[model samples]
Target: MSLFSQAFRPVGSTRADPVLVALWVALILVAVIWIAPFVFIVFTSLKTNTAVMGETAFALPTDPAFSNYAKAWARGNFSVTAFNGVLITFVKVPLGVFLSAMAAYALARVPMRGRRVLFLLCVFGTMIPFQVMLAPIFKQVNAFGLINSYPGIVLPYLAFGVPYQVFILYGFFSAVPKELSEAARIDGASHFTIFRRIFLPVSLPALSALFVLDFVATWNEFAMALVILQDPQKWTLPLGLMAFQSQFQRDYGQLNAAIVMTVLPAAIVYLMFQRYFVAGLTTGAVKE
Candidate 1:
């Protein structure tokens, strides 16, 4: 019998394996535990403030207040904030990934003195805490007259984001076979051409994974945005959510609705890139 069949079969008689049954039960319990809070949030978003205060936390809403979303959207000024969030995330994430990919390619493939040192420096950057650089970064940005603008937030995002992206892309790029580049070089392909035509096309899995991760990080980033974007018009989703909570602190339904809206984009991006994400992380792990 196949291993799958044997696993499901009785151990020695008519009864199923107790160990397998226990494992399955444990998995189900863990799944429920993880999902319970999200379920509560969704249910609460559909409830009125009166209903929320009067009813049990887990009880289904007797009268769902779908207008909560509309109210939250208007009161929170989400239209402006959501646009700002999308603009920053979409611009920063892809540009950062592309720049990191190029740096990784140079580190992995180019024959240069001190390449190892440079790569190590980039890796070391990832170890430093953002909190440590906050004051210095703010001063520099202000000196450059970038505060209260898109570039103010984006420049820092790119700077901080590139190190981790380079670390990930470097591993994947190193795993690529040298033969492909060698063959292209023999055909008179320039280094840039080889990278654009061959390396980039093959590195989609890693790139997509990075895109999703960076998208989520940039989308939800609040501290840097708060520090740099002084204008309420330039606020991102996270900032908008905080403002929404403060203004509607007593309105549980509208607050939860705003929370759900803020979370939805990142969740959608993850689901879209879910297939490549796992493969990308594992691809270079056991390189030959």
Candidate 2:
């Protein structure tokens, strides 16, 4: 059953609450509102430019133009940009998650000195906005001779991705039973072994959630990528898509098609990992 059905379904003699039903209706309405733009964009993308301009903005195309995607890809240089996005996201997400998990595990489970300070530093990082550091980061990347390179864009992602990830994983780690770690230690397991064998298996949901979240965030991030990557060949999808617009005229069809292409990967990633995303969010939210 759907979430709304499951939420409202009466278990026995009692009818569903009127308020609950009202809330459900409101939720559905809100969802429709939220998704309307995407639906319009998809339909508009399939239409010819002349049809889009001449016809009612939301009307269905008389003849669909599937070639819009190919035209967008060619004009936007998305073949290169998409590959860059994939490479950066793939490289950054796993490394950031692993390192963040290690840091979280240490803060949550280990009796190491200054753990509190380190954890506090991580927390502080999460509070700071990325835009505040953008100029400095760009200069640092340039200083390190990483400008317009994969590593230039990727390094900042790793740095910025970690604190938030650590914040998420720390809650999950802290929820783990201390006895499990103690038992592993008694079995002559090192900290690495305990983390590898004990915490990791139990944290799959959170990991998968972070994987999806990080993939989407990294894939969509525009400002940082724009600054660090100066070359058109190194541009990510968002920058590539912006190429569809010039000062005088915008190719709405091509622009919309590029938007759809950019949205597809993140949608696919979320769908693949969605089973874990909800559970992960709720599981570590309350300490038992």
Candidate 3:
């Protein structure tokens, strides 16, 4: 039998299984729909501006121009901007996760007055949209002379990052058996020691997941970065991509190249941590 027939046909049968064939066809269609734009961007990045705008936007580049990436990188000042993004992501994500984890541990493990109220307040903070806080945050940043600086941007990232991380970690910490902590406590382990040695190690999957998430969110964030980072030197990759696109508005190839560059780092970061992310997500799905 031909490969096509074999693929669509059920074993021990001369004809295709209608249900399997339909499902396979639907999957292929969805896959194409999902991947079409990325494929277009790759093709477009190789074509000239005229070709991109011309009748053959979907056509393969007849005269592939590979220099667009080099040109976009140079024009976009991506080296510095990408580095700035990495720096900000590296600094903020760890701090945010650590702080959030600590808060979560206390909320989950410690008995305190008004704990429910405090925990609900943290959850409530997440509901307040970032857009609503923009004006007030900008004002506060300016008042504290944090505007036009890295700390200014980093601090807000941490603040916004903490609540969600805490919420997630809180659940994980809660799910941990209290018997372990009790055993360690009977051995004279301090709260800090127990947390540092026990809770953190066991929560690696969740922490890894949160780290990946916060890193991407901080990296792609544009509105606050644009507002606070006035200097061109401190612009992150997303801001740099926007500025590059505007400056080379007519150069679709360059624009697409810049976009590809902007996307690559985040994609790589996600891929690197994807295993842990998926594991962490499934950690709490079933009872032990």
Winning model by TM-score: 2
Candidate 3: TM-score?
A: 0.88
Error of 3 at 94 (Å): 1.5
Which prediction has the highest lDDT against the true structure?
Answer: 1
- Give the per-residue lDDT of model 2 (tens digit) for 53-163: 898867888899999989888877789999999998999999999999998999999898999898889999999899999999988998999999999988899888899
lDDT of 3 at 259: 85
Residue 145 in candidate 3, Cα distance off native in Å: 0.3
- Per-residue lDDT value at 35 in model 3: 86
Q: In order, what is each prediction's RMSD in angstroms?
A: 3.1, 2.5, 3.3
State how far residue 186 of model 1 sits from its true place (Å): 0.9
Model 3, 190-260: lDDT tens digits are 88898999999999999999988888898889998998898989999999988887789888998998888
True lDDT of residue 195, candidate 3? 95
Clashing pairs in model 1?
Answer: none
Query: What TM-score would every model get versus the actual structure?
Result: 0.92, 0.94, 0.88
Query: Backbone collision count in every prediction?
Result: 0, 0, 0
Question: Predictions ranked by lDDT, top down?
Answer: 1, 3, 2
Deviation from truth (RMSD, Å), model 2 = 2.5
For residues 203-270, could you state the per-residue lDDT of candidate 1 as single tens digits? 99899889988998899998999999989999999999999888898999999999999999999999
Reference-based lDDT, each prediction: 0.91, 0.87, 0.88
Give stretches of model 2 more than 4 Å off.
1-9, 247-249, 285-288
